[model samples]
Target: MFADARKIAELAWPVLIGQLAIIAFGVIDTAMVGRYSAVDLAALGLGSSIYISVYIGLTGILTALQPIAAQLHGARRYSEIGEEVRQSLWLALALMTIGFLILYFPGPVLRLARVPAALHERTLAYLQILAFGLPASLVFRVYSSLTNALGQPRLVMILQIGALLLKFPLNTWLIFGGLGVPALGGPGCALASITINWTLAIVGMLLLTKLDVFRELAIFSHFCWPVWRRQAAQLRLGIPMGLSYLIEVTSYTFMALFIARFGTTTLAGHQIAGNVGAVLYMTPLSIGIAASTLVAQALGAHRHEAARTLSRHGILMAVLIACCYALMLLVLRPLIIEGYTPNLQVAAAAMPLVLIVAFYHVFDSLQVTTAFVLRAYKVAVVPTVIYAVALWGVGLGGGYLLGFDVGGAIPVWLTGARGFWVANTASLAIAGFGLLIYWRGVSKRYLQVDAVGQVR
Candidate 1:
């Protein structure tokens, strides 16, 4: 048990750091844009709310590559793993192309959302520019998943660092027009991201080709219909997992729409809180990824006992990290909000919301980590259903009833946000507990298989 715990921790730490860096990029981007104007910041926020639906929704489905690849690696099926990678590359390309088409037609969608006329143009521009990065982003995810599955998470960290480095200077140049280039304002950040993503994807592909295990498999040498079908099977397993993530993320996306209707200032505050929460969320998010990979690999090796043991330790570690994160948010809530926005009202409005988010992060951690593990077992449907119910039934439904339907003073609306958080936490707790139960049953079945010598 101790050995398994150590292995999980080793895998999770680098991933946790990489997640933090990704979050930091958002924070930096928000802070930089905030300096320009509150309207610019608001536009970025609203635009991002729409953009994230595509980014996370598609990436979530593609992320299934991690556990699938890890399981194959653990089973010593190197050739199959190579085939899976090739299929994932093609799958990512298709998804990215579809996403690009969607981005090109954002006017209809933005009009549907009924965003303020003033913010609409900027938001559309930002969305279009950001759309160009989708292909690179998807490709990067595939490479990152393959490397992590190979038990080398540090490569991801390095790749992320490289991307971030490029982002900072390019953002500065394009956003502010520093290098004899016309300032593109809010849209500039998206352009910078697109450039950085393509660079990372190309570099990641090169690095992947050089890996020892991948080289030995010669998966690059073969391309056939059978391999494509097998890869499609993995995607089928991943779709539910992807949908589960979409359900959760889309709930928040809809919530952002509701907040947008309130006013630009309100939307800006909401965006700040959301970005901060996303940054803090990196810790648990990375831990979940690590847990998923470890659990899948252990199961593939027919070490059901080890898989269960790793999950227990991973959950414990995740909870502890969540606690620390919540504590930091509590102590530095004001500083955190103030750092991002110069507008006094925006900062004040966002402060209370940050507190609500702090609480959400705790349970959010548990639910996400547990869900990742459940997906590794290919039991995604139940978790997806649970998420839909929680987000809509509790979080969104409760927020509407409390915030507006049962209207009152400003304090009441403020409290309503917290009520939404409470609903989210409750739903996450239920889902997390349910998954633990399901995992126990799966573990027992695997154990019986081992006893019957069917595992080998």
Candidate 2:
């Protein structure tokens, strides 16, 4: 168990660092653009929210390549890994087309948000520039997923760090009008991302040809025409995966939108609390991905018991770490809130939400880690259903009732963003336990099937 834990750690740290670096790109953009103009900042926020929703849903489909390629690598079917990647590239292009169209033509989505007239042109320009990067970003996701499955996440991590390093200077230059460039404000951030993404994609592909490990797979040696049969297989697992991501993103998006009704101070508090939660989430997410990679490999290698054991240990580790984090947050709540803002009113408002996150982080860890493990088992559809029921139905629906004091059944203390945080916490607990139970059942069934095969 300890050995498996160590292996997971090895794979997880690189991924965690890499993800942090990618997240920093946004942080830098926000900091720079926030200084440029308030309207630009607002546009950046809206534009980024739209871009992330589109990117996550489409990349979720591309991520099906991870488990498939991992299983193939474990079984030593080297050629099939290459073939699966090729097919996913084709799928990426198709998904990219859909994503690009939505970003380029943002009128419909903008109307839904009821964006202010002042913010419309800037936001549209931001999304349109970002649209051009979608193709490269999706292609790089294929590269990322393939490497992650093969337990070579360092390949992806290095490039991510490199991009982040480039992001700061680029953001500074483009946003501030240095080096003979016009200060494009919010749109400059979009341009920076486009340049960085294309650089990563091109360098990543070039490395695949240059590296001996990838050379062994020969992924680009033979051209593969689109195979509907294989594409169908990917979509079977991917469509639900995509929907699950969309559900998660939208749930949070709507929560923020609804919380906006409470006014600026409350909204600011929610953003601070939400930002902290998002940062903490990276830990469990890394663990889950590492575990999924190993578990899928074990299953592919016909070591069903090993796969089961890895999954169990992975979840246990994540939850235990989450508990520690929760305790730390509980103890340091005041200091944490102070760091996010100097306003006493905002700090006071954020205190409760941040406190909720202490508990919320645990269940968030639980659900996220378990979901990733299930994906290793190629069991996404059921988990997607579970997320929809728990996150959307219970979390969002319950929040609306409690936050507004609907029917006057709620106390004043529980109304507003606090109510939403409390409800979201409960919903995450449900999702966590539900996904854990489902994963156990699925793993057991796989073990039973393997036992039967051995008996034969």
Task: Give the top-scoring candidate (TM-score).
Answer: 2
Clashing pairs in 2: none
Provide the global lDDT of candidate 2 against the true structure: 0.94
Query: Which 10-residue window in model 1 sums to the lowest lDDT?
Result: 409-418
Which whole-number lDDT from 0 to 100 does residue 372 have in model 1? 78
Stretches of candidate 1 off by over 4 Å are 35-40, 116-118, 178-180, 225-228, 259-276, 327-358, 405-415, 452-456
Q: Which parts of model 2 have CA positions greater than 4 angstroms off?
A: none
Score every model by TM-score: 0.88, 0.99
**Which residue window of length 10 is worst by lDDT in model 2?**
207-216
What's the TM for model 1? 0.88
**Top lDDT prediction, candidate number:** 2
How would you encode candidate 2's per-residue C-alpha lDDT over 49-153 as one tens digit per residue? Answer: 999999999999999999988888889998888888889999999999999999999999999989989999999999999999999999999999999999999
lDDT of each: 0.79, 0.94
Clashing residue pair totals per candidate (backbone < 3 A): 0, 0
